[model samples]
Target: MHRTYSMRQSRAPTASQIENPPPPPSSTKGGRLFGRSNFGHAFRKGTAGAFGPDLAKKLSQLVKMEKNVMRSMELVGRERMEVAQQLSLWGEGCDEDVSDVTDKLGVLIYEIGELEDQFVDRYDQYRVTIKSIRNIEASVQPSRDRKQKITDQIAQLKYKEPNSPRIVVLEQELVRAEAESLVAEAQLSNITREKLKAAFTYQFDALREHCEKTAIIAGYGKHLLELVDDTPVTPGESRPAYDGYEASKAIIQDCEDALTNWVSGHAQVSSKLSTRARTLSQRRKNNASKRGEGVDLAGQDQPMKGDRDSWVAATEHGEIYQHGQDEDEEEEEEEAEGEHEETNGESGGGLSLMQRIGLQSKE
Candidate 1:
């Protein structure tokens, strides 16, 4: 009655139709060729009987095992990377320690060599002063002998003729001879034999002290070399089998001990040498001043200002009496600077390459 063409509802869909519906229409050529629904239906149809429930369950277990193996492999790879990074850092630290030890040993060797050089220089100065004193004595000996002969002749003449013109002329000649002798004596006095002797003694002592110190330093250096040489080289490796850090530390301690002993033993000797050197220098200055007075007297007669200026410059230079204090100060300053740099390097921690890379990636 409702136009009641509920036209008997079309017969219910058949079982096959209900289970496998027709594909939907597509708008494009590619879509028609391989539509999403068609692909899913085809896949399901193709695989429908390929595996039974039991086979699928076994396949799932195999897949899970494979995934677990992959995860384990990834975990092992990460551990290996961490170990490699640790080894790299340790190797770098060992290299840095070796370099530091080597540099310090080299500096010690250089210092020992410098001390030897100073000893030689001081020895040479001592020898020169000794020779100068000998030359002064030799020159004065002839003047003394001539003066003695003149005195003898005058005494003989006085005995022969008390008022003779020859006697008078001989007396005048004796006066001139005496004046020459006095001048020679004065020149000899200016050389200051006692001061030269003192200088020589100090230099000899200093040379001995330096020799002992050098022996100590050289022994320490040789020990260090031996230790370094004893390090074992492994096949296919550029570095030694052993890092030698502990050995280096022991050697450093030994060196410090040796240095302490040397300083203690030589401190007084050094002070004595310094004091003797200063005294000798003062004596030389006084002698030079007196010689300058004589030079002034000579200038009154010869008007030679150039010679006087040269003598003054020579005294002022005092090359013969110069000490190694300046050099020692420079060496101490250099050591201080090196220590400061080492401290700074130690205090300033650095990041590894991987860590830096990670930070950069994060940024």
Candidate 2:
């Protein structure tokens, strides 16, 4: 059996943004990774563990590999934004419905890319936490080496000068080194378990958020697709003019509202864990409880890792206005637009609301 969407990310700020306004540091979210390439990443990985102490070498490699993962993710996010802009550009010359829908689709896809990039920052938190584990491993290595060195000297003194006066002193040093090594090893064991759990817990929680929001966009994307009329017409017959402008705009507003209101407790999807999996998870929790242990990193009350408003709709006034028209008013507006389309026998005039407002989908 597989784990369901049981993981929840609950870190977004609950405070209203239009009132508080995001701080200036958020400008760094769209910062690009300059001069990065596969070759450079490979070189970094190759050298990571090569010169490190033997005990920490493998963990050093792991740390570098995680950096590689973040780099790849950043690249994907950047490329997706480019693709979204290209999609919008291509659709600009099409008919009104296709043009409007594709433009909105571009907005959604670009938001996806922005979400991905934002996710990279959250993922870094996990990577940095793992680095703590690597540091502990590296620190433990010195004690291990000191203990081994003392042991080797003891063996050499025994062989070279049996019953030498220095042998007893060396033996005493070995005892002290062994005790130090024991403390270091114990610290390493406890830290490794604690940090490993915290790191992956952070990763999976962020992942849940990323995946759920993308799914939300996908659902709205399907709605946008429905607005496009795909009816087949006779070669000589003229098709009716498109009138989905109001509908498409309303859908965008709805999407923005949905995303803004989303929280972990209200996640749309959930999985049904297998009996075995549930049992195993329960056992793990029970064992941790028996240890009388505590965790510091995973549950700390922290500000959001990324901006929640980054992916939502924006306006030209340096403010986001939420439209709250009733269904009757929406239906009336649609009917009026339909009449206008039929009377004109073409699309409406001038730039639409989208162009006027200028959605700042990216930074």
Whose lDDT is greatest here?
2
- Worst lDDT window (10 residues) for model 1? 1-10
TM-score of candidate 2 against the unseen true structure = 0.72
* Per-candidate alpha-carbon RMSD to the true structure: 43.1, 18.1
- Each candidate: how many clashes? 0, 1
Query: How many angstroms is residue 275 displaced in model 1 relative to the true structure, after the best TM-score fit?
Result: 33
The global Cα lDDT (0 to 1) of model 1 is 0.42
Please write out the lDDT profile of model 1 over residues 132-168, one tens digit for every residue: 3433343344456667787888788778876667867
